[model samples]
Target: MLRELKILLLLIIVVGIIYWGVEPLAHSIMHPKVAPADYEFKDLDKIDLSKGDAQKGKKLVTENCTACHGIKAEKINPPMDNASSASSYGVVPPDLSNIAAVLDHNFLANFIKNPVKATELSHKFGDSNPYPMPGYDWMSDDEISDIVAYLASIASKNLSDKDVFTQACDRCHSIRYDKMVALTPDADLERYLGTKAPDLSMMIRSRGPKELSVFINNPQKMIPNTPMPRVGLTQQAEKQVISYLEKVGDSKKAQRDSLGIKIMIFFAVMALLAYAWKRKIWSDLH
Candidate 1:
């Protein structure tokens, strides 16, 4: 019994040293500055949204946005087909019908004013390769506020996890595990974003949820000058998107954990039996 206790103590010390000390120190060295997720988007708080008039916004949106984006719920279609739009704009623009539901309000306003700056992709979308959306800084804040109101009023509610991920991420990244391809082809995305977006099928497993959330909220801070944009998803939508990624990447996690518990039980029983047999043989020898 004393010998068994000593061996157990040795095993515990080895595991504690590796798990509690070495692993954390290694992770800290590897990821020296992992920034926290910024769901609030505090920088874009200047606009006063209370002054918005949805009726006026409707007219403004019809005059401005319809030429490029389609609003399926409102029965508005883009003037050009996907191929034609891709040819003209370098990538097909996403529909505007659900934009308000997923995107943060403050971030949305800033994105409209200056997409390059808002997305933090000015490093790539500079003068050499112009960004597709022309800045709307000339529009009055009141007009922009009205547009935001109209968008919020029209947005669909209670979007599913898959729907949230589709709206927030599927436009740029592909999930090959789910058989979902990116909306924009790799060649066009390469030209538009400075590189093709990475396939996100295994990102959840690789990066884990905490890292994914922080990186998604602010890609620029995670990797300086990353071509990937700060998507500006609302907190709820961000959670939904990450949930869907976990569903796709770790679908069998529950089953795997259950099996692991069973395996541990089997090992414990075998260890007890082995110890009992050794004690029986040693009793006769002593």
Candidate 2:
């Protein structure tokens, strides 16, 4: 009886070690640079946003941005249609109705000043290959601040999960399962990101939540040479984006989890019954 008990203890230890090595230990080796997501905009400092004026910003956007981009919340439409814009710029400019609410404030300010540098894609664009969005460096600091304030004032605070994902990711990455294709053309995305972005339809299930969160927060941390820049989404916006991805990628997660529990209970009961039978059959020998 003591020998049988010792054998069982050995099996448990072996199983535990296998699980540890296969899961956590292997994961640490694979993703050695894993880090927590950072939502702060610490890159470049510009004009003070507190003193900005929305009305002045609205005038500035109309005068400067409406030709290419649109502000749907303010009923501002792009002058060109989708196909024409794509042909001209290699990507369709997205609506900026909620950018200020979702994107980091300082990042937004710096992005308006220099799109390539703020996006960390200057290496991708060069003197001959200029970035599509012209920098508004000539605009005064106060003017840029006003534009940021105007965008903030018009942005909806309570956007849906889909809206958050659309604003934050859909431009580069497409969710084919949801029938949402990328706004940027594949060739253009490749030129900008070094490779075309992957479809997020099954990314949540493929990469898992923990990995996805850290990657989205800051891509360069995990992939040192990847051209995918930090999106700088607000925490709430990042959560909403991940939630949307989960909804699309793992819609039946709850049902799968419930079924898994039932399977575990069945296996556990079978194991107990088999052990009892083994002991009963060996009783005569003992």
Candidate 3:
């Protein structure tokens, strides 16, 4: 009886492991999963901060963005200005008062054009249908840059480089700036662990430094049931993550190319499987 019980327990453990692995595989196979894509911010690195016209940008924002984003760029859904009642959607619009301080230009631009990629909180935090923000892909790159400049000018506080780096980057990643610089770009650090590491390229494209920083500080606050743990980070790490994101945003085109390669690889694997099945290649093994 004891031997039978032990065998049953072992079988259950094996079955559980197989089940867990199969779920993710099934999701990948059945769903037409849209892999995250990078956004190319044209010539953003070449932007001349000295030449930025914040006042002009502000005027343009008033004329165009105020209707949806708000006059002070504070409220959108519940109406920050009114505060009398929440919107029918029961979600308060995100306040943009400290947007420049809280988010990087790349993140801000992505949010304006594709709110889906702006913050993981959007997907993780609320219901499936949170208040929808309009996409402004029609806006010119210059106009977007100008708006960023204007926002930076009005923001109450700008995070110091150290503060940002410590709070954001160090929270989740085991990043050593000096060590990172010393390693060759192609070095596979995870080879020692016999497992592949998660690609950070997608992370940079999907989230800005500021949003990442805040999420690191308290993931539960943003998304109640998030699997991410809150790693207490100093402000410096947060700033570093923000700076890193800015640099990543400049290489957005390259990131997109990499994403395309991944998609091709996925299809290639699927094709190989189909060919093998057609040829009965696994008949003996099965």
Candidate 4:
């Protein structure tokens, strides 16, 4: 019995070693190193603004940008209705009309391309504005240069239509005009129009004024699956929102009229089919 007990104790020690050590080693081997690329610092000392194309930069802004930056380069375009209110992230979006006057072109370009690196350098070196600006690394070096050039063109007086929107609506929402405008494929335009958090882009493109009115009156009734709560609106306010959406949609590649017509046809066909089926079933029952 004593000999058997000694053998069991040895087995337990070996099992414990395998469980703690060998298991971890196996896991590490299974998940081989998957690290990010090594950081390479660019030398901004040789950048020449004379060679940059501001026109090309403007085109890039119109195509890949303008969602957050606004067409007029007025910092937060489509300014929030209220400037003093807290945002969803508890921070307010700042204005950018005078950014060129404040920051160097190279500094702006580098910061835009790699926000994390810019922040680290700022913290290590002495730079103003410690806020972490989000990166736009997807843009090529030439594109970044053009963006910087176009940004330099923004005057304090040349605010866009978004600025007008901000001045009107910033009272309640955390209106970060720049951030919202910068979002691509025009994602925020529908939310802005609906006054509720629904991807109304598809609906806006597919449905017309009449259909939108029905949904707006009682969105949950029309779309039970939708998370949008019906915010009671005056007829005038609803029209304004619709008009805004129509204009904004036209400016972008998204077309609402086409979508609205398709939705109408689909529902009409379904209704006719349902009526015929019901009539046939009733006759058979009789």
Q: Pick the candidate with the highest TM-score.
A: 1
Better of 1 and 4 by TM-score: 1
Q: How should the candidates be ordered by TM-score, best one leading?
A: 1, 2, 3, 4
Selected candidate, larger TM-score, 3 vs 4: 3
Estimate the TM-score for candidate 2.
0.89
Clashing pairs in 1: none
Model 1 TM-score is: 0.91
- Tens digits of lDDT, candidate 4, 1-286: 4776799899999999999999989966864433221122233323445656778876776665544333334434643422222232123333445444334466567766765454333332225433323568887777888877876776344434444333222322332322332221123423322233333334446776656655554454455535333333334445554555455544453555678889999999998899799779979988
lDDT of 3 at 75: 37
Model 2 is weakest, by summed lDDT over 10 consecutive residues, at 38-47
Show where candidate 1 strays beyond 4 Å: none
Off by over 4 Å in 3: 1-52, 68-85, 120-131, 158-286
Error of 2 at 262 (Å): 2.9
lDDT of each: 0.87, 0.84, 0.50, 0.49
Candidate 1 vs candidate 2, TM-score winner: 1
The segments of candidate 4 whose C-alpha lies over 4 angstroms from its true place after superposition are 1-48, 70-76, 79-86, 121-133, 156-286
Instruction: Give TM-scores for every candidate, taking all chains together and pairing residue i with residue i.
Output: 0.91, 0.89, 0.36, 0.32
On the 0 to 100 scale, the lDDT of residue 225 in model 2 is: 58
**What RMSD, rounded to one decimal, does every model reach?**
2.0, 2.3, 18.8, 24.6
